[model samples]
Target: MATVILLRHGRTEANASGTLAGRTAGVHLDDLGRTQATRAGDRLAVVPLAELVSSPLERCKETARVVAARQARHDSVRPRVHSDKGLTECDYGEWQGRKLRELARSALWKTVQTNPSAATFPGGESLPQMQARAVDAVRRRDAAVGSAHGSDAVWLAVSHGDVIKSVIADALGMHLDLFQRIQVDPASISVIRYTDARPYVLATNSHEGDLSWLAPKHRRKRTRSRADQDAPVGGGAGPGTPA
Candidate 1:
């Protein structure tokens, strides 16, 4: 069996400033965010990190590097940082760089609430579309990383709140709406494991140094979607999906 560690990036200046930052430029980690990264890195540093992959977005990339560097894994395990467009935050389109609450108070919120799939983020991507892109990206990543490894692979993917939630939802056989229920704090660690193709949640939405459960009660009512997603919404440099 292979172990996979899913970690969310540290908080960023954009998060503190209340900006959408969808693929925006110059949105880097703030002081608190850096501390969050360092602490998260120290906590996971003990684990044997086989591979470290991050969202191409700066926040996640920076966080991944910090964690990989701190992990003392280079000796026992080879750790390198790689970027994946698939692992990026949701593209809020025209909504990028705007306060989510402000958007919720605006006219756009109605469209999003009513027809989430049809509602475009003005210039960004939809929720379902984001779910598709993130799911596909992770699947491809697991395949690539699993194939490239000679021994058992333990992979870590650092990503945005929403992206990670989507991945977790897919792993748990849930929907995008359930994403709202699964909370991913900044610098959190959510674990998903696979004995074969079937995946079970070992943990979800864990903050730095968290040993508690993020809840594992699998809902039996919802139907699991098997649709495959392969493309990215707005591609790269989008602001992370802040919960």
Candidate 2:
């Protein structure tokens, strides 16, 4: 199947202020967030993105536009950014817009930190529910892109930190409680490729490094082999090497 690059939206006032922005409206990226998004766009400029999907939230939309704009300067096709509600930030409900420090003091906070699978936001959804929707959205979109653009196609998804983390956790077969262990910094990029057998996490929370290797290359016709569904015995020559 096609590969998907998960991009967390850049920093925001809430992030700098240590608040939970959640699904709050009108929350946009701060100045540093814009620069961060721009840098991420620059890194991805060499790759041809088959699709650019983003949360409808302002911050994510802003970041997605920057990435799509960069692709426009290089690729003949200007990638259109599509909004997906499924990729939106978690519904923190009453916790929305609250300072993280204050929330940290609540008893539920302990449950959230230790057993997110059982934690539920007051008036909102559970961690499992959020993961279910997010994983479903990513898998559905990945399948669509693969069918439309072929296995070599690469795409992007700009979303919130928790949303991206949940997706990554699902890709790694990790339990929801362990998801908090994963760190998704602002504008960080993570890569995942799904196959009939399983999903491969190629990268995580990557802030720097040459991503041009992700650029899709034409594949020569060949018979399918076990390597197609399994990792190479030794890490396999790195990307760009022939099988």
Candidate 3:
């Protein structure tokens, strides 16, 4: 299957102020956030993205546009940014637009930190609900990209910190309750490749690296073997090398 690059949106004024900007309109990337997004775009410029998907929220859309623009400069095909509400931030409901320091004082805050599966926002959705939709959206889009562009295809999804963490947790086969343990910093990159057997987490919470290695290589046409569906034993040779 195709590899999906999960990108958390750049920082915003709300982020710096420690506020939950959940589904809030007009919340955009701050100055540092724009710089962070630009750096991320520079890193991904070498990759030939098959598709670019983003949360409908403004912050994510802004980040996605930067990435798509970078791809346009190098690749003949200009990657189109597609919006997916499923990839949006968790509905914080009454909690939206509130300061994190205050929210942390709530009794439910403990539940959200330790037992997210059972914690539901006062007027919004549960963590489990958020994970369900996010994982579903990524898996569905991954399948479509693999079918359309082949197993070597690579794509991207720009979303919120919590939402991306949920998807990463699911890909790692970890329970949603443990998702908080996964840190998804602003504009950081995480990668997952879904196979028939299981999902392979290639990288996570990465802020810098040479991702040119991920660019699709030109090779002879051949059928995929069972090895392609499974991880090599004894930590076999890495990408672009003979196994």
Which prediction has the highest TM-score against the true structure? 3
Q: Write the per-residue lDDT of candidate 2 for residues 1-243, one digit (tens) a residue.
A: 789999999999989999999999899999999999999999999999989999999999999999999998877567999999899889888999899999999999999999999999998888899989999999999989887887778999999889999999999999999999999999999999887789999999999989999887665322234567688887777787864
What is the Cα-based TM-score of model 1? 0.77
Query: How high is the lDDT of residue 194 in model 2?
Result: 84
lDDT of each: 0.70, 0.90, 0.91
Give a tens-digit lDDT track for model 3, residues 71-146.
9887756789999989999998999999999999999999999999999999999999999999999999998888
Give the TM-score of each candidate. Answer: 0.77, 0.96, 0.96
TM-score-superior candidate, 2 or 3: 3
Give candidate 3's whole-model lDDT: 0.91
Per-candidate RMSD, Å: 11.1, 1.7, 1.5
The backbone clash count of each candidate, in order, is 11, 0, 0
